[model samples]
Target chain A: MRALPLIPLLLGGWLALPAHAADPADARIATLFNRLAQAEREQDFQGTFVYERNGIFSTHRIWHRVQDGKVIERLLQLDGLPQEVLRVDGKTQCVSGTLVAGVGNTPDSSGRLLDPLKLMSWYDIKTVGETRVAGREVDIVSLKPRDQHRYAFELHLDKDTGLPLKSLLINDKGQLLERFQFTGLNTQAVPTEQELKPSDNCKAVAQVPPQAAEALASWRSDWVPPGFELVKSYVRKDPQTKATVSSLMYDDGLARFSVFLESLDGESVTDTRAQLGPTVAVSRHLTTPKGDMMVTVVGEIPIGTAERIALSMRAQDVQTKQ
Target chain B: MSREALQESLSAVMDNEADELELRRVLSAVDDSETRATWSRYQVARAAMHKELLLPQLDIAAAVSAALADEAAPVKASRGPWRSLGRLAVAASVTVAVLAGVRLYNQDEISGVQLAAQQSAQQGVAVPQVQGPAVLAGYSESSEQATGPMANGVLQGQAGWDNQRLPGYLRQHAQEAALKGTESALPYARAASLENR
Candidate 1:
């Protein structure tokens, strides 16, 4: 009689397994995500978009053209300050004054497109339904964070072009943190060179080569949230303070954060925390055997995650000699 | 305990109506896999009824616990005094947005970056940034006057390395994110927002 009772329980457990099993719909969603990533670089489009966060809103115009695999893109802020950025062949050619200053003159390599497999590890990507954006039908996809370390994203991609028509960043409370939506879009033909050219007022930018590029071996975090990994590390000389600030960047595929450490040079400075839209900045003083330094964690992450990162910064004394 | 009783206690806890005894019961049972599963289901069902986008698998408890474990102990001694001061500084600097009817007149002197950066952000939402007590004392004069109207007024007269360096740091972070982030024009907008001032 006891064996008979256990039979149904065993059958129930077996039935529950398939709910966690890989479904065909999931594969289809992943394919859609990959297409979205690939479409950005491969497609040539011009569009007007508005980015809104908190209470500030701004409109921008983008002219992205690809010729013989060399991508040329120009972005201009339509509303305020006439800020413009022009990039040729994946490197920044110039930017409007007040946009970027004191940067070194080095060629920037093209950043890789978002990898669907990597993002899958951090977010539960799923197609929620369909919607309309910019007068075109779009498929709504939600990339919910697996943990609290990152925010969730809802992307509405054009069904015909796979270009993102609208994207939203939502906090754990489901409150909209930021919104990027295309007010208008054109997906056909490459933009003319004249349209891609920046205004004469656009100042040339200097790309400084990162100092700690070779051995980011100089600092390490004692603890990072699970699935997060160091993506890049470098040292930059402060133009105003003349301090060499070492920075380490980490990402959990879907979300990214950076830690900047700078020596105080005996100048008194208080720790500070500030949030601008989805970005949070936390500065904390750290005392190491070598000396006193200040660590700032800045990223589009939860305040708690930033705090933990600020606390986990450790000097890599073993590699100090280098 | 019966499943029905446990479920009732879970609901009560979620609704913030649980008594002391029920609270203890829920906390004690929180570690059990089945109880946790049940709790998650309740939360999802409730969220669905409310039409909220609730993630069924967001394990915030685990993330927070992990953060707690990683918190450094060395900063403990100096954190106490500065934390209180930090709150005061935050309060003094916060700009209360009078939502519907308040008109922002003549913000011409404010840079685009400054206006864009803090207008919606300075609502006293937070986590205290812990610095050395001595450092806080140095800026005590300016921080005391950090109240809404006086905030920028104080900063204008202040001649400190922070005033010179912080903008650079903010701009650097934003620009770097723009260059490195492959997402879209959002980073570009952010970098541009930093220049309005």
Candidate 2:
């Protein structure tokens, strides 16, 4: 009798092992990421959240509403400063005075949605467990980085809405580099138009297309960490310095970094590396045939990785016409 | 000095109007946790008004004090540059160095020490080829503080060539992040933080 029972148990165990060995776990994780990416854009809700890194902590109130197929979002800082930003249809309509000033004129580049297939290649996404955040139940999902170049993220996403209520950026040693978590959430009702209106202090921004410079296309990064891809590149002249700064931005779907190359114009500047909260800025001098250019890399990455990215930056020599 | 007087001195310091006596007074009490908290609050209020970027919790005085404490043994006996400055001047210099370090670049060349500022970012760097450009001049890294100004979590405008250019770079990086940011309000917060005085 015991043998008969053992036979079924063995069969059950054997059946489950292969099924688990396949892509079901990966498929589930991908589905969760897809839902999470879609939720923030499609959903209409309001909440209060806090962002913290190192010794700095700031609280904010966010009201995201979608009406008539247009998404309007308003964010206001709760402490320290009354900073505010209002975006309509994924483009910034106005911003609190002095925050972005003249920089807001550039055409907005719509963000890349979280691609599960690409993300799977760099991160091992798994359903860790369940937890409660902001008075709502959430499923804990871990995006463990497969390499050392990036940090791991443990996201507590709301079960019903699939919105990330709590997210933590953790280093390999388990040190928390930065955290973004909601303290309160309300998904029941959409925010009103009046609530989304820019404050009196908010100034409308003008969008100016960057002047076309052919030199930007000639510059390229000789090396970048695996899984990272160049997302956007452009050249813009500095209003203050009057030097054309060529910028290249790269992203690994989740992590992003920007590289800026500006000619010194005979002004000597030493190489520098500084870390601000979770963001690291590294400036290195690279001598190109055009001139001595200052290459700076800024992003939310480890200092070593950033420095490597800085050193790996190389200018492509222009081919002479026959 | 009385507690109220010390508070007034702290305020005066934040406003950049404090005399020598008031500066010394605030430095003495800066060790106390309450005093530090009050200092942070004042910084926050001032930063908010100026629309300046600030890391409210960064205790520059405390980091200086820790740096001083670590150097206690050798300071009393040696006639080194630090010893020549005297105790009072050393304390004052600590304040000035930490504050000014954020906004100024070294005119004189300082060898870039790759490992010096690697305080917390020393993990997972497998490639030895990418050690550092060199120890940069004016790049102060006390035992308690990381890469001085940058690690302070705030951007203060320093009237220098590099200082002027740095803000543009920081803003461009931040604004680009915000524009391309589909993740959440994190990028937006980062962009906003850059605007403070």
Model 1 DockQ, alpha carbons vs. true complex: 0.07
Error of 2 at B156 (Å): 15
Which numbered prediction scores highest in DockQ against the true structure?
A: 2
The alpha-carbon RMSD values of the candidates against the true structure, listed in the order shown, are 21.8, 16.5
For residues A128-181, what per-residue lDDT tens digits would candidate 1 score against the true structure? Answer: 999899888999989987666778899898898788888888866556777889
> Against the unseen true structure, what C-alpha lDDT does each candidate score?
0.67, 0.70
lDDT of 2 by residue, A1-322 (tens): 3135545544554455444446788778777887887887789889999887655678889999877777788999888778898887777777775543335545645645777677766677789999899999999999887666777888898999988898887765566767789999999878887888878988786775654344455686766766788767777776656787888888998888888888888887666655555676777788878888888888876666776788777667643321
RMSD of 2: 16.5
Task: Report the Cα lDDT for candidate 2.
Answer: 0.70
Classified by CAPRI criteria, candidate 1 counts as incorrect
- As a whole number from 0 to 100, the lDDT of residue B175 in candidate 2 is 78
- Highest TM-score: which candidate? 2
